[model samples]
Target: MPIQQSGKRLRVPWLRKLDENDLPVTLPVFMAYCMVAGSLRSWNRIGTKTIVTLVTGDDFYYPVFAEAARFFARQIWDGQSFHGNVLQWSDKNFRHEAEALRDERAILFAPLSYQIQDDDRLLSDAVVPLGPRTIRHAEAALRRARLPITGESVELLMTEPWSRLSRAFQDRRDPLQAIQRLRSLPKAIPPAEPEAASPPSTLGLTLSDTHGFGSGLIEWGHDLAKDIADYKAAIIPWRDVENGVLISGPPGVGKTMFASILANTCKIPIIYGSASRWQEAGALDEHLKAIRASFEEAIEKAPSILFIDEIDVFGSRGETDRNSAYMRAVITALLQLLDGFERREGVVVVGACNQPDLLDSAITRPGRLDRHIAVPLPDAEARRSILKHHSGVTLCSADYKVYEMATEGMTGADIERLVRDARRSARRQSERLNGDHIIRHLRPLIKLPKAYVHALAVHEAGHALVSHEVGYAHVADITISRWRVEGDYRALGCVEYDVAADRPRTRSFFENAIAVCVAGIAAEIEVFGSFSQGAAGDDAADLNRATELATAMERAFGMGHTLAVEKFSPDAFARMRASDPELRREIHNVLATELERARSIIRMQRDAHEALVTRLVDADQISGMEVDEIIRKHRRPTVSLAKPERRVAT
Candidate 1:
């Protein structure tokens, strides 16, 4: 026994010293006992009767009932006098319950959960809350007691996730989980900044041996290290109080890396999962049970991070604990855990997901996820740096020149695959990876049959030649095939037209685009004695635009093209093209009229071009070396310079 405390301002007495086990087995059940007796006076009853002292064993039934009896005894019950008798325990106690129930004397209060097997010893007078597994037994017991229970009487309260968390899991024993989670002690604020950090000289880049999430990691150390320093200030105290963060992004972006780095930045342990995965548990209402355990552990661990990926999975529409209950139950549980989390603890909850729209409105409604940051796909600059990171210094050396030019439209995943595939190609060929490594890698993969490649190359060359010659688009390069990466739809045998996307498309520009679109089919037909419909996507897209231009030419410009006197309608071109096949033919004619004339000129040069291709392909690896050999033997240097860029444009 400890001595009572005494203070000058107030006297504090240490009364009866009781162990926690001395408390009732379940406090809520005891509370329910009080509520039923107190509430019985107010409930609408058949007769004016009052409930006073009702009990099963030695325990007192209604402590709160004493107050209700004094206040509402005369007002609500009107003319009743209630007994405070503890009847002897026997089979007839139920008869006493029946007599009271008939006149509706006392209200029955049921426990929130129970096992049917253990509840067999319970008297008939007792009411028990019915769950899915226990409802049949409860109903049977109600019949045996001769008590009339309403359909609504078997109401089940939602098993809250917080309900299962034990009051006991104060501090865990494991040290590894302790350090990794940065979880410890009782709300201690981190040390001051000047004293906290290791000296600046030692905080430089250190190699990491640990891997995460099986995805490729982006080293945003240079960019995000500064953000990390900022986060440490806003975060550490909140981490002491346990805060959460929302990281939003599209798929395959570096959001996961951002999360992993943030964990390392916070120097805390992180347990990552979807809300649903953590909610559902086994025979124990596993999810809710596990949630309770996890939260308790997190609190004990203190400075910990619970990373719930795909948060919107919880906050969707009409969530409840009934049928289709798993989603709703999980959401409800998460909300409870997140409730009242303020002023920063030593724990943090971080969530990430791609579909922000799918999340419940409650999540973003202030206070919940206070911060949302977008992690977009890497732009051209990020892509270049990513390439430099993946490629060794020797591969990126000045003489190598592989990454000298901007890699226009590659993803982080794409760049990773590019470096890996290129290295494999270099190994297979027994050649060192150098500037030409990518060019050779592109060869075996980006293949068409030799004749097809030649014709397609000519087709691409013609589009490039005419588009530049007609001053429609400046050609970037006339490559025989697209970049060597998989799933890339850039183009096969492409001539990239450099367009500033922010600028709007103009009239003469449309004319140049149409010419280039048609030149491929025109060149293929002229060289191979027929045309393949390989340019369908190009032709379809161009024809739709051509009709719009044709309509504008006639209606707006009044150039006597199609409908000479009318104002333009959005569907007018569509209706005309649908009504007359010749209209589509003529619209095609209007777009490609000049390009057809240019294709005839390329056809005249095809024989000489075939000689150039044969010489290049036979050499297996074409360069300026093969091009010069062909030019020296075939015609003259004149043929070499006959390309549209080298020639005088008319």
Candidate 2:
């Protein structure tokens, strides 16, 4: 029967013709077969068989089929011969033939398992066209028309296709019904696993293995699926372009891993390695040999990705000078290789660097690694997903409570390490992998001391307290305990501060500069009666910033009266170097005065300072309420500014 097209699906005939010209016989034979199939009689057992001459051993391959092939067989039964049935010619060249003859009658036959003679012309032929479904279903339809599985030809069904079709067909009560049932079956499901550790095949072998073919690694991200989609989208436009991408980010944030994931999404063969190791040898011969071999092996398959990780290890130097010959040679050869790579379809060069600033500048000039992106620290939601993914298939926990607890402020590497540690803890106790076990193990890692903890709370609270009290900056979570560290000193005491609305650290803020800088120190001094190094690092940074702001206020913005002249301090350090011997005394006195004023404000509101610190220390970490309570208790008379109108009325 004519293979009628109805949208994407095609109506199957009892048999499919192997050669094109057999349409003469095939057309009638298929019409009869369709009549039978369409009839109320039996759909099975109606196919015909006849003398199939063994022109050569290959002729026997024209096996019986269920739907399409059976129709063709029935047509041939009426003294019809077709060409392109893999006729083993005398020349022993087993190739597709353009034409075939049947019984002295000129009948055109396409080669069995044929190649299109001219793809353009064949595709343009309006008389016969195949949809993707019809063509892909062609073989299976032909298989159904063949002899039953119990027949002698069952040995031929042992092939992978045969096995697959057999498993699919074995369940059908009728061969005709099998076709419908088979197509209706769902696509095979992959094993459901939360975390799958790649095997030793992953060692030195950076390419991915998607089932059988080598591919790229899956990337790590907070939004794995979305970022993967974005990475894929970013590459879509450049797929045909002869350029590369430089995936850069902080260390342990998965640049190399992202490179692989991008390659995988591209559905191309990927070969990956680090440039740092290759350049160490300092010889071009070995380095270039490896790169050459990698390219040759990869190029045999046209669509491929070459991934070089830690590319900044080339060390920001002139190609001919500090860099090894191998470094220069690798970069040069890569340029040459990339320049010529586009001749092969679907090939790309992808690289990653932790420090783009450390890379030789030329590596990023357009053609080499053009798209620079940072795979930053995962946000809270991302952190949860990553933690869950790493946690394993069974998420016995109600929510991502433990994941959130364990992964705060952690990079992808740090998160993975925590998960591994959690799993290790579970393994040690032989306990069921669940949130309790994860939490119990993680609890000790994040615990810290009382005074130190209170100090942290007070310090951050001081920043937030003064900022909020003065209407300067916002603070998010003021944390006291080390929620993500192991010991007392290494404990993280932090105030996740908000971005200032007006970018207040500018030079013009110097009139109140010392106030902001010394607020934490002042708060520390007010609460504890003595200051420590808990906020010292911040102090130094703040001090330098304050001084710079002070100079800017005095000189640039004319906001300071102390300068009293137009001269700018040529060099800040030089001014210090050349200052009058007693300038140090005045400097200390000025800093002390600013700090004292900020602290005096705090001392008057001692209850507020204590309230904030005590609440944070007790809760270890508190949110908005801690902020509000501190503000409520810290009310004091400040000569600096008058109370608002409502407060005055109250």
TM-score of 2: 0.48
Single out the weakest 10-residue window by summed lDDT for candidate 2.
56-65
lDDT of 2 by residue, 1-650 (tens): 89964332113443434444443222212322343232212112222221121121221121112233344334433334433232222211212223322222111112233433454233221112111122223343344454233432332222223212432342112343343333333222222333233211222322232111111223322223343344456744434454466766655565555555555555555676556445322235656766676667667864566777667655543534322554566667766766544343345666776557657767777766666666666666666656666675344445465556555555665666667777778888898677766566553444455656767777766766666655544567676555444432333665665655655344323435456666777887777787776443321345554555444454445444454444353234225424544545545555676677677667777777778877777787777656866676666655542112222232
Cα error, residue 491 of model 2, in Å, equals 5.0
The whole-model lDDT of each prediction reads 0.45, 0.48
Clash number by candidate, in order = 20, 19
Per-residue lDDT of candidate 1, residues 119-175 (tens digit): 323433333221121344323322322344344322211121112111111112121
Residue 415 local lDDT, model 1: 57
Candidate 1 residues lying further than 4 Å off, grouped into runs, are 1-243, 275-284, 292-297, 319-323, 341-344, 390-487, 490-650
Error at 614, model 1, angstroms: 30
Measured against the true structure, the TM-scores of the candidates, in listed sequence, are 0.34, 0.48
Query: Which ranges of candidate 2 are over 4 A from the true structure?
Result: 1-245, 248-251, 284-303, 318-350, 360-371, 377-384, 391-443, 446-452, 469-472, 482-484, 488-491, 500-505, 509-518, 537-597, 600-611, 614-650
